[model samples]
Target chain A: MSYKAITLKKRPETVISEDLFDVVELNQPDLLDGQVLVKLSHLSLDPAMRGWMSPDENSYIPPVKLGDVMRASGVGDIVESKNEQFPVGTRVMGLMGLTEYAVSDGSNLNIVPKEIPQEAILSVVALPGVTAYHGLFEVLKPQKGQTIAITAAAGSVGSLVGQMAKNLGLTVIGVAGTNEKCQWLTEELGFDHALNYKADDFQNQLTNASSNGIDLFFENTGGTAQAPIFNAMNAHGRIAVCGLIAEYNKTEASAGPSWVGIIKKRLNIQGFTMPDHFHKFPEYGKALGQMLMKGELKYRAHTLEGINSATSGINLLFSGENKGKLIVKL
Target chain B: MSYKAITLKKRPETVISEDLFDVVELNQPDLLDGQVLVKLSHLSLDPAMRGWMSPDENSYIPPVKLGDVMRASGVGDIVESKNEQFPVGTRVMGLMGLTEYAVSDGSNLNIVPKEIPQEAILSVVALPGVTAYHGLFEVLKPQKGQTIAITAAAGSVGSLVGQMAKNLGLTVIGVAGTNEKCQWLTEELGFDHALNYKADDFQNQLTNASSNGIDLFFENTGGTAQAPIFNAMNAHGRIAVCGLIAEYNKTEASAGPSWVGIIKKRLNIQGFTMPDHFHKFPEYGKALGQMLMKGELKYRAHTLEGINSATSGINLLFSGENKGKLIVKL
Candidate 1:
């Protein structure tokens, strides 16, 4: 039988256009002694994909190579298994790439419960949830009553971060690109304030929202809102730089705020990606599962239909048109 | 008796000129129950003095207000004391201001050994050495066989940082402003390599010197050297922003490198000032004293005569003219 997959055709110069990828047909591989065959059901479309498409030597993980299946995190069900741990008909999730079927050696994929919807699992129990849990509790180390400003607050990781910060007794100020997203953050997720970064009086809105200056900052988007939030930080502030969605496609990334503020405020800024902390995923995933199951966390998934929609649907993330955590259904 | 001191007449706009200060004379204070009078013999002119002159609300420590004695670190001998721990003829070091005499209630000043020269005490046992120790060991948390790059390599703090990193078995690359300073770093201070930031091919020299990418960066002067060093960092690099001597005097402090590198390399950047860690002084001072006594550390002092010279001598630090740790002998 044949399966379809997307291959990285070329490295991105600026924008991640269609020319960067090629759809190809391939025969399903026979499973080896410890391997299992997974038919992908849902795939995650993330901002981190932009970094993976580029060929930066200093990137946290190696870029997806030309002529190779494009890398992605996905949920699937086992159809053929040569291993006892993951038997046939088990639902699993892992970095199974942009493909309909994958042959895994039982190393990558993990068994997940079947009762949960794929969207809920992808949005709250997979990469987004784990990233948010680690970046917040480990990196930011929030204390009760501290004010936290999070950029890209309407997106997958940012939404979870805001929810987690709120749970820790912190005042959460969420920054999004549009009014609708801002409204959703405050109304749906219980964020203290959600200001649109595009608004003219965004800085004023942020100041009014945060009566006490921001003590912790979780940076996901690096654009117009970066400097203002950086300037508003209090003494001994901590910043966690998780992603730069706005900067990924730019020819030249914008300069960060002056180091003078860093010294004066005695700030500590740390940059991280989820891959580095893979060991803690199980630990984080379990805690996040509890948060979701107990009604402490809320998530919305903007899932596109069919595998082919992934190519064009990804740009929705960059344009800030996607209303929720983006995913693709096969 | 009346003693001379320099008072900040006005806040600095750009340069630290003589017009901003006034040579004032004040009479000795009548002793209170626990108050003591110190006849300041030596003063240290450090780059951090420039930050104290600015009225930045977010500054690590409060700025020196107009009509106040200009803040500085100094070593002096106790002439009169009501406290037994710091009695008459005892030597002490603290932020005694740019003066010939100061009154203290034994709260600020700490007693030091009288045998060591006041210049040595100020250069190594006081601000410079402690600043270097805390920044290197506490903030950077360096390991053996790692590569460390330090800016302002010839300055008081940078010199001590390099020597200490050397003691830890790390390869050290020191960036300075002058060739003479560079030579002193390599030949006298035992730094593995020293590159002059003013050199046209400084980046190339740094690349050659740090064959492996920089694992730890001790940033002192944030100018031409900052971005290059930032870009040259290895995976999981650590940065300690101790000072920005080059940026402090500018009308507008320059912007730092884009945070993209921070994310790409999973870098950690921490900005620190000594006042925040005042309690650690005794602990750091003890370790530094052992290094000095055992001849593990070497220092040179550029001492200016009389209190009046302090006004003019401070500019030497900004101009990169002072060859060694700049000090005032009164």
Candidate 2:
């Protein structure tokens, strides 16, 4: 049997175009010892994948090599298993590539309940949910009644962070590019306040929205959002910086406000890669799954059908075109 | 009985001139129920005093008011005592005024060895030594073979930090203003390397000196020194910012290097005031006193003979004229 996979043909200029990924077919690998074959169901598109596409080294993970199978996290069903840990008919999510079928050593694989809705399993309780859970509760550690400011509030991690902060009894403030996204955050997501970042009086609006200082900041988009968010930060504020999707493909450094604010305010700014926090993932996943079952959390997804349209789903993340988790159905 | 005391007549503009301090004669107060009358001996002339002179909102202690006795730390003999905790003839050090005599509640006072040289007791194993100890092992936490970089290397805290790091089996690099200070750090203090910040190739020297990257940075002077120090920082490096003496006297905000290096490199920058760590002083002071008594540590002092000379002693600090601890003897 053969499968289609996107190969990194070349680095894209600004917006990732179709030329960046190519569909390739190859023979399915035989399951070796301690390995299993997974029939991919859904491919997770993340802002971090943009970092992999780049040649520069930023954090823990290395840049994705040219002509290698484009890296992704996907939910799949075990077609066959030579490993006793993961038997046939089991469902798993791990470092499965952007392909129709792939083989894993069961190294980072986990099998969850098949009774759960596939979208809920893949969306609200997947990477986005886990990222928001650990990044907010574990890293940021917001106190009740403290203000939490989040960037890209309509997007996967940001939306979840705002909701989680609210659930933890925090006053949530969100910044989004459009008026509709702002409405969706405050009205639908139960955020205390939301500001349109593209407004002429954006900074003023942010100041008005958060009269109380921001105690915890979940930074997703870095460039323009960082300045106002930092200004509103209280003394000894904690910032859990996850992604800088705003400056991903840009040639030059994103210029805005002075970072002396960090020193003057004495902020704790930390950058984290989620896999580094894998030790806590099980706990986070279990907790997040319970929250979903209790209807205390919400997640949205922008799904693109087939491996052929995966590039478009990834590109939509950069443009803020996708409302939530950008996924490709295999 | 009357005593002469230096009062904060006005805020200083340059070098903390004579007019900045007004000497006035006042009748000595009777010791209260819990109070002790102290005869001032050696007054510590710290760079932090400059902070106390101005009405800055960001100070740990309130600014010395106009017509009020200037705040200081000194070793004094308890000539009269009503407090059971501190008996008469005790040699004590605590927060006092720059005066011939002071009355205290014995709340902050700590007795010192009468046999120890007055200069040695006032210079080392006091606030400066404790600052170095707690800032290094407690905050920065340098490990063996790792590189530790310090600014103001010839000063009290910086010198002790380098010596302690050396004793802990770490490679220590010192940054000082002059060749003499650098020589003292490398040749006498046993620092592995010393770079003169005034030299044209200072940044290159610092970078070359810490090729393995700086695991810890003891930041006493924050402005110009931060650029080179940060350039040499390792990933996840820790910086203990004890003071920002470089920018302390400036009337306007000084332009300095961006701290975005902190976010990119995942560095931990913490600004600490000595009082916040005063709880560890007893433990730190005992250990540091042992180090000094064993001849494991060395220090120097630039002493002013009279209370009238406090202004000149303070001026010497900004001029970088003092080789070590700047003190005024009463």
Candidate 3:
């Protein structure tokens, strides 16, 4: 049977339009040796999807070329398996492109258990959840009672980072774009304080919230949200330069105060891509999954219907229209 | 007997004028129970002294206030001693200040061997040598065959840094102000290459010199010297933030490329005062002292005639007039 998949129509402009993607029919491939065919159940739409759109020199992975199947990770079931490693009816999620059917070599794919809800496993316990876990615990290694200021804190990674930092005994402060996101962070997510970065006096509020100093700065968005937060960093602060969602679409280099402050404060700023720490995924999955099952973790999964809606779901991420992990149910 | 000591008459502006220092008379104090009266000999005048002149908040030590005895480290004779730890006629160097006669509690002081020439011990094997040793091996830990770049490469610390990196099997590159200093770095110092930063095509020369990529950046001077060097850094480069001599006396913040490149390159920038690593001094001193005695290391000491001439000597550092360690003989 023929299956439907999204293809990149052309390179995007300042804003991603529906014209960038084309939904098309494709042949269902026969499973080769050591391969499994998966029928896509849910597709993960993340901010990093923007980086995969066009070729760039500085990113972790090569960008998606035009007319190719758009790259994505999705949770799905095994319809056929040529290898005993993954039997028929086994559920899996890995580098499955944006399609109704996908075949994997089982190189890096893992089977999802029947006990875990496929949607829940695809949502809070997905790559976004583990990215937060490893980035905060492994990269930042913030100590107890230290103040942690995280940007995009009400979003998927930021929300998890705030909760984890609080669990680790840190004074967690969240910087969200809206009052609703901030309220969720402070009331529901256990963040000690939340500041709206869109507010005029965001810096002032941050200074009051992080009175001691920002020991750990988990940067997600990189423009105006980052500028003031950088100023509030303490001496010898550790900044995990996780993502630059703020500068992803912008053409020009964003201007800000001199980082002589970085030298003066003796800060450690590190740029990280999640794949660099994939070795810790098993450990992260075990711990973070336990926390979720115990009711200690609260996460929201924003799902859009149909694989064709993947483009719009991804764009909503940059526009801040979605509150959490923006996924597509195929 | 009255002895002369250097005193700062006024804070310096342009080149330090003759009137900036005054020779003052003093009655040598009787040694207290744990004190010693030292007859000061070789006084060290460092670029860090220029840091002491400005009223900046961030400092290794507070700036020597106007009309105060200028702060310095020196070798001296213990003419009278009541302390059991240090006997009479012992040669010592510590915070003896810029003076002919000074009283020390022996808290910060260290007794030097009478056999080592006072000038040799005070010059090559002194604070500058220790600063380079600890900052490089302890902080940067550059591996063998790696390219290491140092700013102010002809000065006391930078000169030693190039030599030490060489000894550690690194390909050393020096960035200096003049052709002569550049020649000195490449010729006498055994550095692989030296780039005269004053050249119009200095950035090109730096790229050509460090063909492999800079693994360790020993930053002494800031501003124009540092702007382009950022591009030459390799991934996971370590920068020992030794000093910013270029901006030490400037009243305003000068513009340069921010360390955003550092983040992209995954650089580790650490600013430190020597006192912070005082625990490791004994280990450094022993290794460096052995290197000096073997004639494997070389240093230049720019000697000033009298203690009263300290102001002129200090300003000479900013003007880049001094060839090496600027010191005063009292």
Candidate 4:
């Protein structure tokens, strides 16, 4: 049997392009002992995928090698299984790659609940949701009456962070690229205030929005946008370095904010990856699921049809074109 | 009684100069009902003084006002006491200023023990020692067999950090500006390896010295030297931001290490001020004193005589000229 797969052909120097990958059909091997063959239904496109494409040894995970099936997280159904634990037709989510079929020995695989919607599973209960959970509660440790400022406010993780901050009785200020995204943040996501970073009065807007000074800065885009936020940070503020999507595509080093701010403010800046804290995923999923069931948590998934659109769908993340979680539906 | 005092005449733009201060002779005031007259003996000069001179509202403590006696910590003897708690001839230390005489309400003062030498009381058992202890044990939390890298390794805080890290069974790598300071770090301070950041092969030396990767970075000097160290940091490394002595004299913002390194390495960087952690000073002083009594912890005090040398003594910290704790003996 043959199935389609997207393979990394060449690493890009800057922003990802469609030419970097090649979609080809490959034969599926027969399932061996304790192995299961999964037919992928959805592929999650994340900003971190850019880091994995870089040939440099700077990422937490190893770089995707040339001519290999591109690494990705996806939800799928087991079409054939030799493992008793993962029986045939068992739906699961894992690092299953951007391919039509994946063979796993049950390592790094999770059984998806039938209750959660298929699209919501990847956006609200998968990597982005869990990442937002760990970063906000575990790392930032929000306190009541504190102010939280988040970048990429319209994106999956940032949107979730703003909602979570609000639920905990903290003020939420969000920064996004477009005016529409800003409106969505404040109106749809219930953010206290949202600023368009591309606006001419962005600096003034940020200062006014964070009048009490930001207590917790959930940094998603780390570039020029963070400079003003750093200056407005209160003493002993905490910065959760979730993602640097702004600088992810840049080939050369850009001037960062004066670190003097960190010292003078006595700030605590910590960076984290979700996989490292996977042990808490079950607890996080349950909590997130409860919120979703209560209609307290909201998420959006920008789904691209077919595996062929995987390359272009990922570009939406860097371009800020994706309204929410970018995903490729197979 | 007439006594000399160093007053902040003007704030400097960058590097401290003698013109910024005025050595004025003023008549000492009569002690009030609750006040004590102190004959200041030893004035503690620290890198933090540079921050205090900045007219900006960035420091934890407000900037020193022009014409006010320059803020400093010092050891003194009570010459006259209207307050019975601080009787005559009682040796004490506090923010006694850069003056030959001062009047205190006995609120902030601490009675010094006769067991420790006068200079050691200020250098080892006081601010610098307590700062190092809190930064190392409380902030960085070094583990056995880990590699600890410290900048400004020959300075008071850095030197103490290296010694403590060694005692904790961690490999120590020190970074300094001059070859002599680097030599002293390895030879006398027992740092496993010392790298001269000024050497032509500095980057190579840093990479080789931290071959296992730096687990803990005690940052004293923050500038170009830290860029390479950031690249050499291990996953989940902790950076205790102590001082930015290297950037103390720079008027313009210089490029910092790509913050991308922090996210990729998942590093935890926290800046701290000693005054904020004064509650732990007694615990720290006891541990440091025990180490000193065992001859396991050694410290040096480079004392400048008279209040007139206050301006130049402070410049020593920025120029990296002082070999140890920069202090002024009045």
Which structure among the candidates has the greatest DockQ?
A: 1
The fraction of correct interface contacts reproduced by each prediction comes to 0.89, 0.10, 0.23, 0.71
lDDT of 4 by residue, A120-236 (tens): 988888888899999999999999999999999889899999998999999999999998888888888899999988889899999889889999999999876888898899999
Clashing pairs in 1: none
Provide the DockQ value for model 2. Answer: 0.28
Between candidates 2 and 4, the one scoring higher on TM-score is 4
**Quality of candidate 4 docking, DockQ:** 0.70
Please give the ranking of all candidate structures by DockQ, highest first, separated by commas. Answer: 1, 4, 3, 2
Query: Local error of candidate 4 at B65, Å?
Result: 2.0
Evaluated at residue B263, the lDDT of candidate 2 is 44
Q: Report the interface RMSD that candidate 3 achieves against the true structure, in angstroms.
A: 3.3
The residue-by-residue lDDT of candidate 1 on B71-168, one tens digit each, is: 99999999998888888999999999999999999888989997788899999999999999999999999999999999998999999999999999
lDDT scores of the candidates, listed in order? 0.93, 0.81, 0.80, 0.88
Q: Compared with the true structure, what per-residue lDDT tens digits does model 3 show for residues A108-137?
A: 677777677766776667788888887798
Worst 10 residues of 4 chain B by lDDT: B252-261
Residue by residue across A1-330, what tens digits does model 1's lDDT show?
999999889988988787788889999877789999999999999988898898888888899889999999999999999999999999999999999999999889878888778888899999989989989999999999999999999999999999999998999999999999999998999999999999999989988987789999999999999999999999999999999989988999999999989998999999999999999988898898888889999999998988888888888999999999999999
Q: Which of the two candidates, 2 or 3, achieves a greater lDDT against the reference?
A: 2
Answer with 1 or 3, whichever has the higher TM-score: 1
Model-by-model DockQ, in order: 0.90, 0.28, 0.38, 0.70
TM-score-wise, the better of 1 and 4 is 1
Give per-residue lDDT, candidate 3, residue B219. 86
Q: Rank the candidates by TM-score, best first.
A: 1, 4, 3, 2
